[model samples]
Target: MDPFKQMGDWKKNMDQFFGDNFWDEFEGIIKPNIPQINLYQTEHELFCVLNIPGLHDLEKIDIYADMATLELRGVIDLEFGGGQVIKEEILQGAFERQISLPFPVRSDKITATYRNGLVYIRLHRLISETSNKRRVNVRLLEDE
Candidate 1:
């Protein structure tokens, strides 16, 4: 009846066949939503926090905000010196993530900062006379 239920059953079978961490081992290749994020909003503002560790240079990260979208691009590189890895879990690679905002935001009124391995972004909601509704003037075009 449920197609997703069969998919879940297949996943369980695969996990049993390959081991519990089979999928996790391919995360770097699969590139699964790296640098997890949390978003919160208020009446006039939006706050977003991203979990990204091992950042040495801040210039590697770029944050962009538009009327209805927020995008982040960055790279996380951690070197462990020429050694064998027993178990790896942390994600480290170049990543780009775009998120849709709940409402329109002022592109010029956004600020972002990184502290303690967390990236914090603050955005102000666009509140203007034309924010909700605006009149568009139509002009007739004449063929040359």
Candidate 2:
């Protein structure tokens, strides 16, 4: 049996098993999730803290909040100068992350602030009437 023929067969089998875009798919799994977040909740409010370094332009970031979700979309560009990278570990790219709130939140009452390479978000809880018990008035019907 020829060793060159065996090597070619092994390569073909790997390509078939992983597909042509195996590196791209593997990179996606290996890359860390950007802007790591931590969430806290109180009786009437929710707080979120995100670790997002190298955010020069605030305009590049967009934050959206609905009743039960919070979405963050932004770009983290850390390209200081063009040079050969020895070892790359920091994640710098465009990212979108959606988080589910513990409870309903008021979208109109959300506030966000950025400081010390961290983004802080404050969300007020939406008190829905359905979640609270209400006493309904009872009326007697008149018979003819």
Candidate 3:
């Protein structure tokens, strides 16, 4: 009696009993995927663009910035009709994502805005490389 053969038999029975749509329904009710995000940086700033469709109330969104990180928290509500669910792929509920900033940023100077179902965040850099430290030389002379 092979263990693999027994496991395969059990797997076929489980698949036939649950069917393919069972897992889809289970996922739809259990966990939702995280929102997609796009990040980029410039010489003096950092930007994060997130694709967050179906968000209506701006007050539900929260943005927090720090020297090396940014966090976005919000919830998306999705309502469906009361009937037999044929197919469902969209996710609805609370979502939070943390992003690590490329360099130190001005937390107080960060700004965010939402438009066309997307959220745009701008983070200003803390310092520019305009000046650098210079080494000083010392000279010794015979006492006179």
Candidate 4:
């Protein structure tokens, strides 16, 4: 029995069972019935884009990140209803999406903005650390 050949066959079997959308399936188990998000990465930084339409205010969007995880939460309003009900394909109501980042991100230097119908956020990969020092003098008081 060849060990390398056996391992290769096992890998193919697992991939076939999971399919190409294994990540999507894994995310669904954790967060059921939530809006999907697309994440991209580069050598310098990470790019995240979410599909949220009918957003009235940009302030409504909230983004938070730690050393290893980046979380996104927001609400989207879908106005539907006229006189007749024919077909509905778009997802309505509020949605919240949370994604795990590959590397550590600088939370303070994070920038985000919402334009048109999509929310864009730019996260810096290599964060420069800054340090500041301050000195204070204290005087002793005498009691009479």
Q: Please list the C-alpha lDDT of all candidates, in the order they appear.
A: 0.85, 0.84, 0.77, 0.70
lDDT of 4 by residue, 24-72 (tens): 5655553354444677899868888777888887777777887657776
- What tens digits encode model 3's per-residue C-alpha lDDT throughout 12-91? 78779998666555452445445667889999899988777778888988888877888888986655568974444565
Q: Estimate each model's TM-score.
A: 0.68, 0.69, 0.61, 0.59
Per-residue error for 36 in candidate 1, Å, reads 0.8
Each candidate's number of clashing pairs is 0, 0, 0, 0
Error of 2 at 96 (Å): 1.0
Error of 4 at 111 (Å): 1.1
RMSD of 1: 9.1
What is candidate 4's TM-score against the reference? Answer: 0.59
True-vs-predicted CA distance for residue 73, candidate 1, Å: 0.6
Worst 10 residues of 2 by lDDT: 23-32
Q: At residue 10, what lDDT does model 2 achieve?
A: 77
Q: Tens-digit lDDT track for model 1 on 34-116?
A: 77899999999999999889888999898888788998899877856678754556877888879999999998788888899
At residue 103, candidate 1 shows an lDDT of 96
- Clash pairs detected, candidate 2: none
Candidates 1 and 3: which is better by TM-score? 1
**Model 3 accuracy (lDDT, Cα):** 0.77
Q: Which window of 10 residues has the lowest lDDT sum in candidate 3? A: 25-34
- What C-alpha lDDT does candidate 4 achieve relative to the native structure? 0.70
